[model samples]
Target chain A: MASPDAAAPPPTEPERWRDLDMLLSRPGNLVHSTFDPSPVLRDLIGSYVEVLVVGAGGLGCELLKDLALSGFKNLHVIDMDTIDVSNLNRQFLFRIQDVGKPKAEVAAKRVMERVSGVNIVPHFCRIEDKELEFYNQFQIIVLGLDSIEARSYINSVACGFLEYDADDKPVQETVKPMVDGGTEGFKGHARVIIPGTTPCFECNIWLFPPQVKFPLCTLAETPRTAAHCIEYAHLIKWDEVHSGKPFDADDTEHMQWIYSEALKRAELFGISGVTYSLTQGVVKNIIPAIASTNAIISAACALEALKLVSGCSKSVSNYLTYNGLVGTHIKVTEFVRDTDCLVCGPGTLIELDTTSTLSEFIKMLEEHPKLLMSKASVTHGGNNLYMQSPEVLEQMTRPNLSIPMFELLKGTPFATVHVSGMAESNGKKVSSLRKLRVAFKGVEEASKMDTTESS
Target chain B: MINLFKIKGQKKEEAANSNGGPPVKKQSPGELRLHKDIAELNLPKTTKISFPNGKDDLMNFEATLRPDEGYYLGGSFTFTFQVSPAYPHEAPKVKCKTKVYHPNIDLEGNVCLNILREDWKPVLNINTIIYGLNLLFSQPNDEDPLNHEAAAVLRDNPQKFQRNVQMAMSGGYVDNTHFPRGGGGGGGGGPCYVLCFWLAPPTLAPNANHCTI
Candidate 1:
């Protein structure tokens, strides 16, 4: 691609993307004039560079078009969403015919058909469905998602890509740069996250205010509102009726059941305004998103992505906030990166006993307050300490789960184990990959601890 | 006037006595939290609430505010608070029923309060919004004002604006225009008040004998 020797018709919309070529032709670019005299270095950035755009909603559609028009030839968009009639007002790439169709596939197809010489690969699946290897191919990952949990999940995955030397310093080569854009009403923000260098999403976790919580007494003694009834059904009645099965918000039957139970409670309480939409909103914690805001934020995200990929100029120095409400107030703030960040920095250190087996360690991971990992696959120094997938790997690792913790550590004082699993975040099941530093202690300490606890 | 604080307690007692569908009716987290907020409501003495429809309509109600101190002292302004089923999670839709010559309050009665809009968070209870509104009367923010004219006047000429406010409050002429004593109608007095205290023949109305509005 750098040579432009392979005969692929001259890049379409050459005039439209002429400035982008000028950017790559600058001395700072990797494929700049030092090596080749041909324009392939400029062209190589387009065809060879792999960029993954996560989410295919309003902002996602804008990112696809913006990235395509910016001369990004290899683009991949992944979204586990269908085109709903509600999405039409802002998601410009979709239409009435596209309703019920996978947003990623349709968005990709529409962008390809509209923008010439740009190829987009669409993955119509959840981000968790794809393995770490699937994400490794992308040079830059752009996030246009509305869900905070989803953003954190991706952020954790990006940080999980980090590898440390013997001195416990993050290797720069393994760092993944992520550009995230979020819009709420006329307010939006675009943040550049080069894990270990800039603040990862988790570093500013407090930036997102806490979710709404209700008192159990109010829920039990006095239910006055429709939300009360919905919560009653969701939290209490569901458990009362279906004991073992977890309540799935996406399941139509489960939702309808909740709605009916809520309506009954509402009627009994003499409360009104319990609509289906409201039920879904309360259950899912849905935010009302506006279109133009999405477009503005997504444009910033895409531009930042381009800047990251092409060294066009200094990227948005960490974070950019846009407010269209009060006469278009845009503020760029450089948030201080957290040095003790669990995702980007050295992980939480846990002291373990040599007598503790891998089986006990797995149980400990599930019980740990900070981790609370319901499911986990452990990796130690790039080796599969344990895997729950691909039956053969699981079989091979199952034996290791019973082995002594000292055997796994193999004379090491401390071992960094990577755990990938799902955690209950914001009341939603979100995939999280974390690095855990385990220091093995003597067998006497283990037996002493067990005796003290048991006694 | 509906005592909203007692509304939930009575409802629970009534449900307990009735032919119950289930032994226990569950409440939403938001509802439970809002109930706590209502129980802990420390409303100012100047404020009062009444459900125009009924106590059953806790989701919608009318709240009257009497500014005890400010340029709007002795003036009573009413607002409607529509609590969505989402309650604490969603900010209640609050709109002034009687318009006033305030910088933060628009001519159409739309208020310029941060808690009701972008700055709203789940932790912000109705009490917070009440305090916010009360603060607006005492110290209105002219910078982010919805009523630009009022804001300009308040910013440039405080004394003249105070005179005009006093004049308008007493059902008298400030410049060349006269305002009805009870309601706010300098320019933007929309006809949305289908029923209110403004129904009485105003002192400023010349054709009050024949006019229905």
Candidate 2:
């Protein structure tokens, strides 16, 4: 169902010819204008071209400029935060006067001023939990997000709506096939996710996890001074949460004000810190450029969306990352899905049935421990201490956990005991644990012999 | 034809008399192209270009930019440019000769600007590249970053970024390492060149002359 405002007259489309005339007639237009006079611009006129750009940062603005220049009719930009004075450095869409302004609004206005003929709608809202109706109207969605959470959410939403075929079979899968664009400093990536067709983000999650393994005490450790703590909180923590706030112009400005306050708090606190001496300045400036690259990738996603909507190119499901600094090296790879995936695996959906409730499932698991064993048997060591089923044991013994075991017998009534220790005549320690072996006859005979010996 | 030969001989004689150095040769078309690009460079007033080896060698030069804004404002930062003879066909090698706190520039001054590397094309001229460099000084991106710490700081605290820049320019310690004098250390016993002169406030304490080489 459409939102109440869906019926409301959509924002008035910009007068394309008026702006086009201005651009063409501008004095320096000949030198600045890079657009080719082609039929593409004429074809796009008056069409309700809906686009969803997820980021309103640097690359996002550039993409908007490109789209407007290319003559796309309708545009929507979604971002959660406002412009800071620092954003004026690389976010060319915002000027010093535009500091503390909502980035989406500033970007939309700039786009309108630079290139016209499209309806620009700025949403100062987070991308997560956005109404599907908002998504359905757009022919293409561009993800100019920075974090994995937003990227994953966008991917999930796309997967739920779009269906792709693999080997001519209609595969029903969740997690929409979408493009994820990200940048960190000067490096940027544009990844396309098609559920069941190409690899999902999860397939390549290991490539860019939270932290890489670093040796302990490899670098100097300094106490978090008040100023340093405040600085850390302002730049690293606040923006992360604030960037996900709902779409409101005032809320966006408040977030910028909060950032300013955090900066002041850090200065008052005087937090001293250390970092890799070589890269401090480079890191600071390059990051926004990288974010801008993400925006470009997001626009590229729009191009791909056009392809998908127009039945031009095959819907891509591969992942691609670009490192601009190293060279615009676009690394594209296919991601294979894990059959045993916890989220999208077969029959793994958590149905809202009487037996599927958390309490009921816990109770069922407690009552039928054997079911746990059956699942555990597929894993190694599950059968050793815990009574596991044969199915699990069979699965565990396949190459990865192929540890050999010996069958040991006790007294007369010999009971078969599986032990991991190897038999040694020299009696040397194996695996740093002392090993001892003893043979016993039949159980009844062993018991009688034990009794006789005791007597 | 006789006058042309005489003129050529006179040029040879002039070349020999000057320094008995290599004969003055006309610049190739490519060199001329690069020369025009460099000549037309409308660098920001904050940016100044110099040839460390002298004006005769335009292929190798340095650019010094004193940012008037952002976290690096008032700090004198120098970047060395080594353009190959095949420049325009290849991106120039740029290094941050200044040690400052930045996310995209490493301590060694190896910049991560995309235009200088992956995104470079022959179509891009010296003017565009300089603009990109100046943009870096004015706005540092924290999202896609080489210096994670600097990026994190810029992303988290713009005010702190300002403080760090001020501290670094004033020759104070940022974190622990001393901010290099004028963002350049006294390396190889080279005399420090004063890139820019600023009138210190009357109340501020007087100190040694601030110069950057």
Candidate 3:
């Protein structure tokens, strides 16, 4: 060895990461930090910044490892999923033997095993299962979920932090920033949502393509493709033969029954293209997940987490779309906030019949185009107007659900009503709170409107 | 951290499976998870979930969403879900049973929610899909629509889209699409009808004038 004392070969594998570390105290990037630079940057990142990575799938596995390697010690991950036989390609953390185990717990265990001094608390439960207080514990939230609903759910959860003052201005201190990353085949995006500061997920809900819905008539009459056959078997045939027994998608025997029945239906309709995977895909709506796509998105998310916690660099303005399919292309666009967003913007306006009961008002939310809430619990001035969750509270509020709208808001004027309940964001159920300006049509206003309508 | 970007060729469908098929030998992880989701369903008061075939058929159920606001106010849109035993791993096939005029929804009841197709992931539950269906009426997307004509109108002439939505909900014809009647929150004797429709406890009066407030 030529000169044993010569700079120690740049600190070797694990420790080498400390050399160009953003949070390292040795003054590489601390010179330009926007906020006051902490003297103990490494310690701040490790002990002070609490990071939460939602989802423990392909990208989740990568995020855990990347975050661990980047010197963050206190990490927590929550995933309402278990490892599947198919997750092996991109979800490197899991092995063949670890199938059917919760992703979060296993990911935490695996990461800690590989990296030293990192304590990851893995909560193997639904995002909704956790209380609002549980989410408040994290300093930063990183998302690596696949479903739009999950992303939207987490997005709304983060945006839910924005509390508006009397002037309709967001309370700055309550703003929660979320780093969201997603991948589709070779296309992926990493976005940062600083509740009040940046355009939220709901603000840019238009960005996502509308959900896929098959026409019922096609399934009912003009069956043309493999999907139609699968649907016919699942929707009609099973019910005809097995009146009281459920057709389980996970059951091999049940699936086989559907597959065969679908084959017969396909033949009957002269519709071909029903394979096992197609059966699974049509029934379960599964898309083939690629390992590499998950990796690229995960890395982007990991860097975002580091930037968010360490304040090493400016966070992504709002959104960044990445496409690796047609030669690597990354585009950054600043999506403007929707001023009338029901989730993160000013409260929406609602006009209702003053005499309508509280129960009727709740029903109206489902029918209302602008406020199609499937379920809701209302509150005014800190008093629970009605609660739709938790058996005990639901029972307590059951009697009040029948109370008329006018009686419920006796003292309030044409003011905004705060409603809270479950909303589907992306394709996931997220707890959402919205502000709706309720102006009940008193008998006089209703008659005036009726006259205006007829004329 | 996986972004559930759908594979291009992949297709999706939702089903509240029939309680008829081969006897479920054992509950898979997906079914177990689905059970948890159904048990913890947080649906709106106006929405109703019913297993028409009875308790044994958790797989096939009808979820009705009655929007009480927006253009579709007082409209009841029912969606049938067929849950596969492979749920959580695969999304349930969902279809709109009601025919209405909208940008994202076709007259045939095809929906355009990403989660039901390419964006679906195993972590999702029935509750999420139900909420997704709820979202369609509240904020109908004009882009990437199944009803291209409606989407075009929504993009080019929003006032007209509103009118169309109103007509569709009232059980009328919108551009040759004959919609069924009822589900309309008509302004005529509005409060009276709201009272009559809900079948609330007989003690309640139909008119707001009699209220104690």
Candidate 4:
């Protein structure tokens, strides 16, 4: 939003920025080694540091407000989900009128309206829909995602940008820091993932517990618990009765039918505790979200983003867990990075002749002892060199298979090529994505020769 | 330490069994599912289920199959099932107690059944799995075989495969792999019969041996 008067000069130290100025202007022992105590640091945070909030849900709303008030001006938020009445409890930025509107747009507008001078751009699209270059534009990415799959996807995307040098050391400039915050009921966690320095989400994927699943037999036959009954109604009975029609959990009629069915099953089996709300919870797999928890978690995430960009203090070693349930418990755990991490690490390096064709490289990959990839779909820097699936895509990219490897890779000496195909893992065929560092034999020498000729 | 815990558990079960209408302890969803599945079971005349740990401990049971028709006819194969509390959600751990020559079942009693692995859905009950196991005996799929040699023989030479099955069932060695005598006369009974019952601790170890029928 533009200021009402163009001639009006910006406030030197507004009351809203007083708290932020105190931290940035003062000299402190905890500040980063490269940190310079100056007013310019405040300006850097106010206008220069571009931060992207990955979700516009519970924590997203809080993050936008916190970051804006912390003197961050350039903020972008992306979310595919629209605002729902159910999200009103914790997602305060959205109102009853804004129910069907895109969460990112509503959240951005609300935050911008409340906090003047803070520019918030909203992208109401899936995270995967955005190109790799789109993610690279932001200085820092703050994730407020709830789904593990989404977190993993964004984590891989962030780590995908990291570049390593000749010595296998990660280039600091290429490290796109991510502050991840998650809340479930009264429990929450905030983690700073410096792609190359700290463990990426994939490295510590074991931290997430596997989803709870009830066997179909149990639901169909003997449902001992209320949840089993609900799941029975939702999973089996709905499909049997509906036949061709798919059960939409969001549909009021569909949910009502499920609830009634669940109640009847519970009654038949002498089971109790099948409520309408409980049925919704079971079908949607809703995690109890407390507003206070979101605020607390988002605050931690926003502070980390500030510390990372401004070098105000060392980022919380790596992870922080908060439990406000029984009393209040907060713990910080430091996690180490995996050097051989397929996502973050410089992948297995392969030297190729400049004249080698894409099809020839695929043949070499199959024969290569380290990577026996069959029917490999190759992509270099988001460019589809060749795709193995979806007949149409495969047909479109088929012509590129005859193109020279260097030409497909833009004649770059060192490039990361992602090849996905069926590979044997633990004696079983599994689809695997392998990142390979391709070094063209003569490209580096040719570039050096060009420099010499120009000089 | 585990034995002590087992003893304490056994004492509790004994108390509940003596007082029995139903056990004072609530049945888990898995146990309830197993009970319903067992109650509604339409087992083939050749198949029989037995609660080795008695009816009180339904989670751990045995199913003995005497294939009346097929290459495995007159040969009894027993499998022990250890159902978890998470049953219906998770597949029951079924292990073949009696080993015999088969393309789909390995020497270690690991049956290569699709439903028991990735294809297992909650809607599938104990009956479906038993039927799948029975089908394995009758058809002996060579495409997704566990015993590679047996699969190769079955695929390439039928007479040799028949000889291997006969030799293995009658307690002989085929290609250096010894098989105990499992074949008796083919037995038939009414469907859905519990052939045997024996009281054992809930923590009864799965014995890798044939059922004493």
Candidate 5:
């Protein structure tokens, strides 16, 4: 008989994760083609995998709960918004007392208190404040972001880590997977993005509708609706009354002043329904967040993340949308990636010596047969290495031109640089951003750094 | 050749200086648009633009309109224009500095021009507004009026409205409302042809002075 000490530790509450264990341990016919079922697969999720939850609002709160209960033990959440009295209805994890606190911190604390054996780290800062290395640490990223800008930023960060061989095929090991979910009123969408394999956020950016803007004349003069009145007070009157004083949407006093002024304007215009809450909604551009919609979307996102990590089932084909306005309607669409996508596809590869200066690089870009750029503004990993405009930025980054490329890049032997310049398209000079993969020769051991397949 | 980079740099410096103190403010899109609008302003010969607070302060200015032929003909009216920094987006607030007995111009000096109110558009610039104000003098619409009494008089009796305007231009009283002396004399002793033109009110005459330039 095996010694008791050598035996595997007893499973804690064997029934607690019975459903998850079943899915991970015994695969069904619908499982992914690469899926290999085993009891160890369940243990991998609890022990090794690290998932990042990128928001702590409505969908974010539900995602934390769903992911925690689904055997993802290590989780991190980041949010820049503080909880408000208005967030109480949909953001379930936050209570009345938690108002004025960071949504991430409060949500993390609440989720940890409810779920056992789960560790959640909260980052109470903007997503832009974090370093690229911080994002690279996560095995899977689950997004519950509201804005297109934030989604695009994180998507670029994940895609920034992708690499390709000489054949322009993405290296499987370098692809960072992301599951994104968003809810607006009774509509929501859940999408799975495997950086290089699937269409990234930027590829289908047109899916989002442009924001509605009231004509300035309507808001200033006519003001037929209550919204026009609120917009008038928020956009025009506030500036005219307080010249030099910027209206902070977050400040209570400023909001109160706008609300009162809007109310007065509404009364003058004989338009009703101008409330303080409505004023905040208009000023902040708040989307009507429905809790049930968030719940459904977050569940979909969590399942996609699980399928991606454990290979228990085939993930949703790129994108899934839900509409609950009239009746429950759900659909999944297999979206294709853009072949010439600037964000995902491997950029034009350039080989150069480590001793090449930044000025030489700019000149090379202009003279390169494929690039043929007129004037270049270069950035690496979101940091501006050299800029060619605005005079101030150009002057500040001018000194970098004299420094060696490797010295500017510091530790990395190879990195992707994003360059914006005037390039000829259809015989006309058009400004566009071109991604370039720059590899410095003789900087490190060539054999160890060689990633391109000879075949 | 226009150096866009150099012009942008100078604009940045000007924006910083105009911002006065502390925070170095960048030139906002609104300011840039306003600058273009002001540069492209095409005013009529009947109208004149002046910066009351000097050239540096473009936000506040005054415009004087000398109508050559209309009910308010030969009457030079000054309007104080307080333009918000949100120009073109928000119509400039204009108040008549010279009081007159007209259907659109109220006792409170509010001029009720459609473009200045409900019909305003961002594409309509200071030039369009100046032309609209001049049009108000040439063809005063009695349909929508801030001064209800004057509108009723203009609608009920055209001749009575003409006499009242002539009395108001000569610093006389009509219906107990006192009027200030205007720019040019439209008194009984003026050019006989001018008085004859006043009788017609030159409703649709090709009066180049007030015609849309």
Candidate 6:
């Protein structure tokens, strides 16, 4: 046996790179590679892997790193905006030299240099209404967008075809699946949407509608001053520089101040208007670490996709939110469709006349004033009157108060009446002035006299 | 000085003379495995292991850890560990004896580590669990938290969480509750009682600094 102090054999650098290179060269080699077979890979086979990264910002870059590390062969990144010096703070894929370059191009180039033998395609285009055509090329779509509108559009497009059917129903069909990543300050959330199976972001936010639809514009539009813009840009740059890096107390405090100020400005305006400024605040408060969290979430989503394709874990029809700051809390909530929704409601028919153009429809509305009469109004209860549509009126009438309103409107041409003193009626108070078309002896007599009454 | 071997020899003689068939030759396999696990423990330098019932009973032991970093710095925390006979296969029952202000750790000392719950697998060992516990001190997760107040503070104002932890560790009041001697498990029984005080409430002066063991 060798002595304890005997010179140890020279350490061997792990040949993991060579093995990885070999695996990359051979498509079939992925199967035999000694690297533990991911439960995700059991499903992803045969087809050329096409991934579309929607936001080439902080989270987008981190996700790119994770994807490249995981050995994904084909990657496509799309972002309309060019990189600014401010982005250097948290957008890891871009460098100081790449300040003026488009985010997508710079990120893709960075990926090429860092991870060889992978095909990365960069697109400098906005994912607006024309996203379907662009999105069709990719097998998977990952959203790192800040706006809920963009997220909703992506979600709707990915899950279903926007084309109207014979019944005028938007043919809800899955095109490409998507994953959504969002962050609020240090906290971050990642959710996977598998078309109809999973609870979409809309479904989850529907219960608490106001929380998701806060009135604020992007920083760029509201705070139009160049100084504010530059300041905001600086915040983004700070985040980009510190991407995937730990922050000290000073840095955290500075970022918190910048973000809180930006938020105050954004709340005063609107989110879209102040995009650039708010982007700065969002980046400072929710980049690098949050982005890293999002990357992990995106990777998990990719794994879930692989599992879904492989039939390991059956299509999970629920939204999974992973919160890293609070110790990896995972909440899976199911989505239930709202039957009474005006947009995606059940049994509600939408028949779009093929010959009518949008402008022509507007002209028709202007020409026929009676079409506007679809909304009829009635006034009741002298003072505290509130306006409501017929549907709301039908729902609000109680047996006791229902008779007086009906009696007052019996001879009127209006289909719906606005009820005043609703607060008092709701409070069970007796009112003296009973406004009516015909004089009634009392509420009991009015109820008895009505021919339409169902006793 | 008397040799330990001689004393053992005398005990064997006494046992043999008292009509025992034979002195028990060696410790059972269960005791042997427990001893090995205890001996091989790679506890941190800041952590100390003790047996309140003396060194003979390895089944019941306590681990004291004084974290040197993060919000819980300068705090002395003790955890009791009761290992079952089936040990490695079954997790040891761990209870925090010190009160800590943390999102993941409740007032009752219940922890929310995934390894202790659904994510636990047979492959994981005690070292991994201990490291995970240490990580909880370094970084507390606010989501899926046992203490909503701590979680909210951690989520809304991380600085406040740090301050609260510091105040609690220094044997001061946090949110109107006094910090226990070990952190959480000092007062034996009652609705509420001063942890370090030896005397009843009426006898003890309010200003006295009680440091009873």
Whole-structure CA lDDT of model 4: 0.74
> Each prediction's DockQ?
0.01, 0.01, 0.03, 0.02, 0.03, 0.01
RMSD of 2: 29.9
Give the runs in model 5 whose Cα sits over 4 Å from its true position: A1-12, A355-363, A366-369, A374-412, A422-431, A446-455, B1-213
* Clash total of candidate 4: 8
CAPRI verdict (incorrect, acceptable, medium, high) for model 3: incorrect
Per-model TM-score of chain A alone? Answer: 0.71, 0.52, 0.73, 0.83, 0.87, 0.50
lDDT, candidate 1, B1-213, per-residue tens:
111223335446545644322111122223333433443456787777665653223456666778899888987778878776445546787777664666666434455565565445666776777777777777765454445566667789899888877876777764444455854423233311110010111223332111111
lDDT tens digits, residues A223-296, model 3?
77888889867865675466437678878798898899999888898887889889988787777777777787
The residue-level lDDT of candidate 3 at A224 comes to: 74
Which tens-of-lDDT digit does each residue in A7-29 have in candidate 1?
Answer: 44545576767776666555554
Q: Which candidate has the highest TM-score of all?
A: 5
TM-score of 2: 0.39
lDDT (10s digit) by residue, model 4, range B25-128: 22233444454465446678778777665334657877889998878887998888988755666678776667667776655455556556545566677878
Which residue pairs collide in model 5, if any?
none
TM-scores for all predictions: 0.52, 0.39, 0.56, 0.63, 0.64, 0.37
Model 5 per-residue lDDT tens digits across residues B131-188: 7778878987555554556767888998999988889878888777677787332212
Q: Please list the residue runs of candidate 4 whose C-alpha ends up more than 4 Å from where it truly belongs after superposition.
A: A1-13, A357-414, A418-434, A444-455, B1-213
Please list the residue runs of candidate 6 whose C-alpha ends up more than 4 Å from where it truly belongs after superposition: A1-46, A69-71, A129-131, A159-175, A207-291, A315-317, A326-328, A339-455, B1-213
Question: What is residue A23's positional error in candidate 2, in angstroms?
Answer: 24
Residue lDDT tens for model 6, B1-213: 112233335445655644322111122222333443443356676676676774446667777777878787777777677765434434565655566777666554545555543334334545556666676777776654555677778889988888887777666777777766435445232112101111112222442212111
Ranking by TM-score: 5, 4, 3, 1, 2, 6
Model 2 has an lDDT value of 0.49
Please give the range of 10 consecutive residues that has the lowest summed lDDT in model 6 chain A: A211-220
- Those runs of model 1 whose alpha carbons end farther than 4 Å from true positions after fitting are A1-12, A22-42, A166-169, A237-247, A251-272, A346-415, A418-455, B1-213
Task: Name the TM-score of candidate 5.
Answer: 0.64
Pairs that collide in candidate 4 are: A214-B89, A215-B88, A215-B89, A215-B122, A216-B122, A216-B123, A217-B122, A217-B123
lDDT of each: 0.68, 0.49, 0.66, 0.74, 0.73, 0.49
